[model samples]
Target chain A: MNMHKYEKWWMLFGSGTLLIFLIVVGVSAFYMGSTPPYCATTLDPENVREHDSFQELGLKQLDDNEYSLTILASAFDYDVGNPEKVIEIPKGASVSIYATTTDVIHGFEIAGTNANMMLEPGYVSTNRYTFKNAGEYTLLCNEYCGVGHHLMAATIKVVE
Target chain B: MSKVEQREQTTDPHEDVDLKGTLFGVAIVGFFILFSWFGVWALFLSR
Candidate 1:
């Protein structure tokens, strides 16, 4: 069949570009075992508090410059084991955030950072992020659950 | 088939047509895709 030489080159170029994407995704997911941003493992949502990880819903320092934060999300509020709902950490610290919903679904998003998660009934969503800048980052439940959804928010204070 | 006919069949019909603009546009699009993919991947890995 008669075809433009440019068309032939274009086809090769387009297919080559697509192949690169597939290969990278395959290596990341299969070879390297990378899953979604968070949301790994499962648990009984009804017994979230009884679980070992969720027993103390607060910050735990794993090592220098590294910490783990756990949060329990319910209707109209986030039970972060603090009355003011403010979590303070030193600047440049890496934090692994884990959250789950006790009653309904909620969204866990740290403003000015990439730690966005969805708190499901029986699944725990987690993400690791470093606090590079020292400031107050608002944590909001972007997913609408009830009338108090707008009021359901916390603060992440990265102190210098 | 004769060698002369085979050569004629393989010849590009629009060989004289200038495709510099098309090639440039394709290259730009390809580069953008690569940039976006790697950028998001790196961000995901770090976070």
Candidate 2:
């Protein structure tokens, strides 16, 4: 009988790598589902800041009745997109969003929070998000047009 | 047929294999699957 060379090595290496990846993914999925996704934006004062918990999207209590945020995207580079900068609307009122790219097409999406919107070059897309309960939401650039696409990310804070 | 020709026909030399193509195809497929899975997870899950 002829023995197979490197068969065991290939099998073990492939299966091991796949198993590790799946395990990491399984853990992350559970954690993400447990915690409400936080919304982040590029218009942050500091580079990064953390919010205690989820609040309403837009409210006057945070000291502003309305807010306007402008972001720039050129070719493949993009300015930051901060969800906290997105005004938190009052309990019953709506928070308006006006977003556009400077050069290329990009999508602005808030995952799991009904904040799905898009942004295009030279044109602003405006939408409103209303929140009754307080929770953190995640904001992400849902478009892939460049090398730094993965690095384009931020969060939105909704505080009561 | 000559005796030498009959002996050469009966003996085996080696198996021909397209290792480079097999490796390249496997690498491309594996990378695509791995990155796509990671990209989706990072995009959707990393909140």
Candidate 3:
């Protein structure tokens, strides 16, 4: 088909840019492991308090320099083993955090860190992070659940 | 044919459009896309 020279160049430029974007996304998601959160595990929200993991929530050392932190999000509260308690872990330790919400949807975000996940009722969300330095990181709920949303926060203390 | 009719017949619609301006706009958009994508890679994905 007969086409203008400018039209041809524009078509080529558009398609090339689109191809580059797709390639970058594919590489980042597959090769570099920059993927969206996945939660196939489900449980009864009502029984979360009784569940073994939630019953004994908070940090547990699994191995040398490795730990697991289980958290339960409820109405305007984040229960890290005990409510209003600061979760403490050793610096330079790898922590795998598992969280679920019992009341409404909440956000699990460790301020000034890459640990962020959305906690929904009945579904378990998880994130793995390593704290390399000793500091106190604030854990805040980014999702608006109720009037006390502003008060829904906790502290993560990475001790040396 | 008259002079006016002859002039009209010779004019091309595509020639009237500014190709350089269009190309410049496309380049600007492409630049923003690349900048944003690389920013995400450097900040979020590179770790």
Candidate 4:
């Protein structure tokens, strides 16, 4: 049978479908790279302190103010796997995080929060986020470093 | 009676194998499939 009669229909459908797919991929790529909302807080894994040294770390204050946080991952703690600690910040503030590995390779990823900043083993990966609401946010190690990778995690608290 | 022989014939090889047209058709179909996949994923599934 001659394919002339059906050629127009085929071309129309084919071209239309192609156009739609191109549009979808373009839009999806745009949305995928977007950062989630979170308050601005700077974190330095190299200088982070425990809850006891809140003032020494310059993180002691409920003044609804914005402050930067510095964290340091030692070789033992970095190697030992355990629950990730959390940091507290105020809502509607911006946060900047810088993380790097000290000993072996480790992963850092925030849980229940829009912070998708990735932490590299030796290299520092920086990411900024703004907190729109007040709540508890946990930091999770996305990549497995070694036997203790499972215990590599932390949290960040957001208050009013 | 004398013995007789019969021969079978086939259509033109070129006519049966449309290399250029087939390639074009495949390319068009592929583009369409990819286009639809992205469109649906972003417009509906992403939401």
State the C-alpha lDDT per candidate: 0.85, 0.52, 0.84, 0.54
Instruction: Please give the range of 10 consecutive residues that has the lowest summed lDDT in model 1 chain B.
Output: B4-13
Model 2 off-target regions past 4 Å?
A1-93, B1-47
The two-chain DockQ for each candidate, comma-separated, is 0.28, 0.10, 0.26, 0.08
Best by DockQ: 1
Per-residue lDDT of candidate 4, residues B1-47 (tens digit)? 88786665454344454456755676677667776766755543322
Q: Report how far off residue A85 is in candidate 4 (Å).
A: 3.3
Q: Residue B45's C-alpha lDDT in candidate 1?
A: 68
lDDT of 4 by residue, A1-160 (tens): 3344335556676787767666756764686554433324344434444223222331334335554454444443431122345577788776555455545545555565545554444445555556777887766666666776676656677789
Q: Identify the runs in model 3 with alpha carbons over 4 angstroms from their true place.
A: B1-16
Determine which window of 10 residues in candidate 2 chain A has minimal summed lDDT.
A47-56
Which docking class does model 3 fall in?
acceptable
Output the better candidate (1/2) by TM-score: 1
Question: Candidate 1: where are CA atoms >4 Å away?
Answer: A1-3, A19-35, B1-47
DockQ agreement of candidate 1 with the native complex:
0.28
Reference-based lDDT, residue A60, model 4 = 39
> Candidate 4: where is the Cα deviation over 4 Å?
A1-67, A74-84, B1-47
The superposed Cα distance between candidate 3 and the true structure at residue A19, in angstroms, equals 2.9
RMSD, every candidate, angstroms? 5.2, 13.4, 5.1, 10.8
Better of 2 and 3 by TM-score: 3
User: Which wins on lDDT, candidate 3 or candidate 4?
Assistant: 3
Error of 2 at A85 (Å): 7.6
